[model samples]
Target chain A: MNKRRAARRRGLAASDDVMWSLMQAAHAVESQLEEALAQVELSGAKLAALTQLVEAGEPVALGELAARCACVRSNITQLVDRLEADKLVRRVDDAADRRSLRAAITPLGRERQAAGAKKVDEVRRKLGKALGAIDHAALKRALSDLD
Target chain B: MNKRRAARRRGLAASDDVMWSLMQAAHAVESQLEEALAQVELSGAKLAALTQLVEAGEPVALGELAARCACVRSNITQLVDRLEADKLVRRVDDAADRRSLRAAITPLGRERQAAGAKKVDEVRRKLGKALGAIDHAALKRALSDLD
Candidate 1:
C-alpha cells in the first residue's frame, strides 16, 4: 500500500483530506473529459445521453431514458428536444406501445456518439499513461464496486 | 492486470466500453455527493466555490477564483453573486490591487463548508465500506494520478 493509504487505514489521515482528494481527483478527470468532448460540440450530459441511446440499439421510451440517465422526465424531455433539434435524435411513436413515444438515434447521432467515444478513449488513454496499468485496473474495479 | 485493462492495453477492448465505464463510475459517485450537498441547499458548484474560498484563508481575486474553479471569470462572478445573495460570501475591494474585487468567505460560509465537508466524509465512509479499505485506496490513488 502507498504511504497515504497506509496512513488512512491506520486512521492517521484526516477525513477531510480523503474527501478532498476524492473530489479533486474526480473533478480533474471530469474536466479533462469535458474539454475533449467540447471539441466535438458536445457536453458531458449530451454525450451521456447519446451513448445511452446508442447502447439501447433501438428507440428508447422517454421514461426509460430518464431512468437510465438518472434524471427527471421533464429534464429528459428537454434534452431530447435539443437533440431532436440538432437532428441527432428523433422522437417517434412507440410501435409496441402506441400510447408512448420513444427517442431513437439518427445516423447523425450515431456518428457524433462514435466521435465522442473516440475523444473519451483518448482521454482515458492519457489517464492510463499517468496512472499506469495496475492503478488503472484498481481504480476501475473500485469504482465498479460502488453501490 | 485485470482482463479489461489488459484488453485495453492490448487495444482489444472497444473504446466505447471503457468510456462508458468511466462515465458511469463518475456519474454514480457524483450523484451521491450531489444528493448529500442538496440537504445543505448547496449544489456541487456552490460547494466547490465555498470550499475554495475557505481554503484560501483570505480574500481571493475573481481571476484566481476562476482559475481555481476551472471556470471563466463571468461564471465565477455569477456563482459569487449567488453566494453573496445567500450571505455565504462577500465581495471586498482587493487592498493589494485596487482595480479588482476579491471574494471572502463569511462566517456562515465556514459553517456551511464544515457541514458540507462532514456530509462528504459520511459518503466517503460509505464508499470505503463498499469498496473496502484497500480498493478504496487504490481508486483514490489512481484518480489522483490522472492528468
Candidate 2:
C-alpha cells in the first residue's frame, strides 16, 4: 500500500476522497432544498433574490443586491429581468440617484417568498431531524473552516 | 430574541445557517477546482467523466460510467458527446454485446487526463494544506452521513 501512502502524502488520493465527500454532502443538502423550492415554483436563485428583498423590507439597489448575492452585476441584471418577467420584482429608478436602478419586490414577491420559506423550513426541519444524531456543531465548524 | 429562539427550536434559523455555510464551503472548493480545470480547458464535469474512464483502465459501458459518476444516463450521453467532440474519448460498440455502446479513451484522452490530474493534484494539495488543521476524519464521516 506504499503507492497509496505516497499518493496520500502528495495530497492526491485522500484529499480527493475528502473533497468529493464534501461536495456530495453539499449536493444532498442542496437537492432537498431545490425540491422544496420547486414546490413553490421558485428556483433556488429566484427565491434567494426574493428572500433578499423580503429581508431588506424595502427596495434595494441593483448593485447592492448583486453585492449581497455575491453575484456579478451582469448576472443580477438577468436575474432581475427574470424576476420582473415573473412579476415578483420590478425595476424602479433610484429616487435619490436617478442614474441608479433598484429592484423592488411586489406584493406577489413577498407572498411567494413567504410560501417558499414555509416549504423550505419543512425540509430544513426534516434535515435537522435526520441529521440530529450527527454533531451539527462540529459539522458547522468544519464547513466554516472551508470558507 | 424570543422569535430567534422559537426559530431555532423549529430548526429554521440554525439549520439555514449551517446549510448555507455548507453550500458556501462547497462553492469555495468547487470554484478553486473549476478555475484550475479551466487552465487545462477542462470543466469539472468533463474531468470527472474522463477521470472515471482513466480509472477503469479499459473501455467501459456508458451506463456504468453514469453510475460511477453519479450522473443520469441522459446527462452522461450529452457529456460523452462533448468529450467525443473534444476527441478525448470515442464510442465503440461492445463486441460481446451487440447494440451496446462503450466509451474507450483515446491516447489523447489519457494524455489529457494525466495533465488534468497533475493540475487537480496541485489544488488538492493546496486544499490539504489549507484545511490541514481541521479534523479530516470527523469531517469525512459527517459528509458521508449527508449522502
Candidate 3:
C-alpha cells in the first residue's frame, strides 16, 4: 500500500542531504562573518544601511532605506533607532521633503563600516583558503546556477 | 598604502562574490523550503525537533534534545514550550529523574511531519532538477569540504 514509504531512505533523501549541506555551509560562513562584524560593534543590517548611506554620499530617505533594505517602514525605523543610538547614523530632516526624515552616516559610521568590511573580507579570504582545496571554477559554476 | 583598495573592484572582490553567491543560493533554497513548511505551521526548527522525536520513537529528555539540536538547554525549553502549545508535542516528567522533563511527539505531530517531509522532499527534488545541469558529485565534494 505504501511502497514509496518503504523505498524511501530511513532519514532523508539524497537531495535533502545536498540541500542541508548547502544550508550548513552558509550558516558556518555567516556565523564567522557575524563574529567579524560584531567586533566592530556593527551587525550586518547596520553595516548594510551605513554602506548605502556612504555610497549615496548623502542622506537617504527613511522610505528609500526601507525599500533598499527590503523591509517595512517600522522595521527600518527600529533599525535606524539602533543605528542612531550607536551614534553611527543620525536622522536628519529631508531638504527635498520637509515632512520626511533621512538617514546619514556619521564619520564614525564610515570608519566602522570600513573596518567591518575589511574584517568580512579577511574572513572571506580565510574561507576561500579553507575551501580552496576544491575546484573553484566548478564551485563557482554551481553557485552561479543557484542564483 | 591604498594600492590594495585601488586594486579591489568597486564593490566586492572575486572571493567576496563567490562567498556571496553561496549565501544567495542558500537563501534562495531556504526561502523555498520555509514557504513549503509554513503551510503546515512548522518552522525549520520545529520540524527539526519533531523529526528527532519521531525518529526517537519515544519521549526525549530536554537536555538531551538541546544537545542533539545543538542549542542551549534554555532555547530547547522555549522550543518545547512552543511545540507543546501547538499540540505537536507534550512535556512529561522523566521517569529516570522526576525533576527533569522529556518531550513526546503527538500523533498529530507525526502526521504533520510526514506531510511536511513530503513537501520538503518535493521542493528538494525540484531544486535538484533545477540544479541538475551541474555535476552533483563535484558539488557534493565541495559541500562536504565546507563541513
**Number of the top TM-score candidate:** 3
lDDT of 3 by residue, A1-147 (tens): 122221131233323356766776777787888888899888777877777677678999999887766568898899999999999999999877788999988999889889877988898788788888777767766866764
All-Cα superposition RMSD per candidate: 6.4, 6.0, 6.2
Clash pairs, model 1 backbone: none
Error at A108, model 1, angstroms: 2.5
True contacts kept of each: 0.27, 0.38, 0.31
The stretch of ten residues in a row with the least summed lDDT in candidate 3 chain B is B1-10
lDDT of 1 by residue, A69-97 (tens): 66789988999999999899999998778
lDDT against the true structure, each candidate: 0.71, 0.76, 0.75
On lDDT, the leading prediction is: 2
Task: List the candidate numbers ranked by DockQ, top first.
Answer: 3, 2, 1
Kindly report which residue stretches of model 1 are placed more than 4 angstroms away from their true locations once superposed.
Answer: A1-22, A94-99, A135-137, B1-23, B95-98, B135-139
In DockQ terms, which candidate is top?
3
Write down the worst ten-residue block by lDDT for model 2 chain B: B3-12
Ranking by lDDT: 2, 3, 1
**A80-109 per-residue lDDT for model 2 (tens digits):** 999999999999998789889989999999
Which of the predicted structures, 1 or 2, would earn the higher lDDT when compared with the native?
2
Candidate 2 error regions (>4 Å): A1-16, A95-99, B1-16, B61-63, B93-101
Candidate 3 regions off by >4 Å? Answer: A1-16, B1-16
